[model samples]
Target: MSKLLNWFKQLDENLVKILLIGFIFFVPLWPKLPLKMVDYTYIAVRFDDIYLAILAFIFLIQLLRKKVLLNKKFILPFFVFLVAIFASFLWNAYITKLIRLPHLGLLHSLRRVEYMIMFFIASSVIKTKKDFFQVISYFFISVLIVILYSLGQKFLNFPAVQTMNPEYAKGYILYLTPDARISATFGGHYDLAIYLVLAIPMILSFYFAKVRSFYLYLFIGALLILLYTSSRSSFIAYFVATVAFLLFTRKFKFLIFVLILTAGLMFTTGEITKRFLKTFQVRRILIDDRTGAVYIGQTITTKELPAGSFYVKLKDQSKGDNLDTFRNQVVLERTREATISGEISTLVEEKKYMASLSANLRPVNTVVSDISLATRLQVEWPRAIDAFKKNPLLGTGPSSLTEATDGDYFRWLGELGLLGTIAFLNILFLILKTIWVGVNKLSFSEKLIGYGFIFGFFALFINASYIDAFEASKVAYTFWTLAGLYIGYYGLKYEKA
Candidate 1:
């Protein structure tokens, strides 16, 4: 027994750290029993139970050994960021009237604590290159399983395990498509796709870890699953990530390979290319028929507009009158303007006029819809900002984004105020700045892996413009884990380097 204990003691700390990384990633899978919390949106598996059980096991074993706690130089930025979060939480508890207080969104404050624990484990536990590679290997393996499951759902029509289970949805990635999305085995296709995008870089990180050529097959397989998903957003994100990765790593050979692939796609996808080119010809080409359909679609023929609607109504005095009078008025007005401008020759043609109007209006409708969704953030953000302007020291409160502003920035401002925003931004800049510093120190293989992590991060930031990615659980987890790995690598090795 002493010999066995000695054997365990002689094992490197880096290996244990790597195991801890695996434990954290795979912990989500262990919480099979779902408990629906009052404040949370869905049934959450009790991760706290699993975490406590693991911690107990670790603590019992550590009774026989000494533990080393590595002090990270970058800890200040992380602490500052956390302080800002608490400050914001407190501020919101005070200012917001309609919202509940005392327990004032304390659930989320606890969730932030959960995140901090994960970050602490990652930053402190991981201490060597061996640990980094081991963590990366597990990431690749975990994602490979996810990829296979998603592909099976997409192609083999694999049945969901929980049949007639209302709480559970179908497939690995459920709700894959309007017809059928490629979910593999995830709860939703979008989630699966997003997860895959995040994993690709981590897998590539193993390139310098002395992995076998078969790992390349795994990478290609993951890419295939992503393609099967046919998620346009994911596709765009992947392409952008690849380009950024190549550029940042200065992988000229890979860049040339991409150029060749682009050329091949242009050559092979003739029909698709034709359709792509046709979009640019929208102005030049107009089918002679469908003028009536085009006109009706273009003209705003009003029925009873919804109350408090943003829609503008003019000449709505007579209920008896159809939209025909307005249509005629529009036509007459256009004809008169054309006559005055000496475009009467062109006005003689009905086809040209209708086409122009329809083309113009189609874009307007699209723009209007886009703006309406975007305006939710725009409107809520200013209010949050105004709140910050009122009290710039302490923030509004925790989860103030949902209460005070629909936006990430404004929510930070409203909850934490200006002081908090600066602190939060400092944390963000610190992470990026550290990554920049690390990238310079890496070899070709390390740089390749780092490129994926960096590019994935860059993609997330771009996506943040459209969606509050940092606010979502899945996206936030992915972002922080990568950030943790990057920081952990540098923190543990800062002295050695």
Candidate 2:
């Protein structure tokens, strides 16, 4: 161990950067710290967070010694963004009752510092062609292992590394089951899926740059795993990114081939094809007649009125709760009881009629309805808008609300207000602006990478309007690191004098 320490001490700054990048790329599966707490099983300081903090510290030492350079172009916007976040956090904590708890808002605001550390390290350290290729290649390899693990979970009943509080995480349980959406090594299915969205384009960039058969194999495996995850938003984001890549790089034939291949996969690939086809199904209307039913894991306040159920009547003292609440409660109670009695009789004759249709069409134990979109519209999005309206300048504050923002735009806007929102957008704009500086200076391979990052970031940005992709730890880490690599690849021209 002393000898190892001596060797480590002897190594120079370049080696430290290389090793940290490798760790960032290769170690998604290493954060399996076996600890659990009430309402939360995940550790407060996860392994990835530790690795990133170390990377940032090493970069700091290099800067102090004048051994490395920082990207000066981004410094203004980056720090401004952090200031906005902290300002909003402070306001919500002290003045407004938006976040209620000051500590929670402060905690959320501080997470930005951790995320930006990666951006700085990546943009500054990985500044050469050799470094860019090596780091991204390692990342591809790491995700390939992720794909294999997902397949194992799907085929072999592999147990998941539990990170969520089991009592509160039905989604985590669903992901672990056979025929379920696989999260692979990541903490959540959305995290895994969006990480693939950011990565699949870049891996394909390698293939287009050199026609490497190894990259081709990796791409195929990654695509298969992405499909198996069955995340509709991920699928959409990846498709758009892939299209942008093909158009920007002028790989029209290859693009056609991939499209055909994906179409073929949709039919030939068992669960994926079914999921893809399910996207087009009419979900608003159900054949059965029930006021409430279980869909996915939530109780659905379904709308196809049972014959005599719709009545514009005053609240009765004898009847408990409001109509909507009462309906949902009944649905939740029945769903819980349905876990025991599978063949419970319905209160309505139309429900019995629809029961046959549901048995044939819907998955077992789930009613034939989709409330995800409705929930976003009625609950999450409206709540964010309400918060934004109340405090348009700085909104509420950091994590003022629960994880219900569903949309990142609203999360940032509603939580941090205009000041935070503008800062956040500026950070992304400057990064992309730096990458955009070189139109003709980049080589074909470099152009492919630049295009891949641009398109990938675009997809994720759009995806954020649906889910809080920007705030998610793994996705945020990957985004900033990729942004750093792209900046290193083509953004060096915009470097400080």
The most accurate candidate by TM-score is: 2
Our tally of clashes for model 2 stands at: 0
For all the candidates, what are their Cα RMSDs to the real structure? Answer: 11.4, 8.8
Q: How many residue pairs clash in each candidate at the backbone level? A: 20, 0
Q: In model 2, what are the clashing residue pairs, if there are any?
A: none
lDDT of 2 by residue, 1-497 (tens): 99988787657657556755666664465534433331322325556666766777777888888767887878888889888888888777787767776666776788888877777777676666677677777777788778778778878876565444544233233335554567776666777888888877777877887788987788777777788777777888888888888887889998998898777766666665554444323222211243333333233222211121111222332433223443444445554576457554555643653454344322222123223455676678889888899899898888776755778988887888898899989888887777767534666776776767778787787678777898777778778877877777676543432
Put down candidate 1 lDDT per residue, 1-497, tens digits, no spaces: 99988777665444446446655455423212344433433324354445544753463354235453533565687677677666556556655532355354566665555554455455555557876666756766667666666666656676432211335522122333223545543334444556666666555555434466756567667666665554445555666776677676576785676557644644453332332332221111112132422222132322111111112223333343244444555556665677678676663465577456434432111111122233543466666776677677765566544532334665666666677678867877787777667766766666566666777776665544434445544445556666777778764444455
Provide the lDDT at 74 for model 2.
82
What is the alpha-carbon lDDT of model 1 when measured against the actual structure? Answer: 0.53
Candidate 2 structure, TM-score to reference: 0.78
Question: Model 2 off-target regions past 4 Å?
Answer: 1-10, 31-43, 162-175, 272-369, 493-497
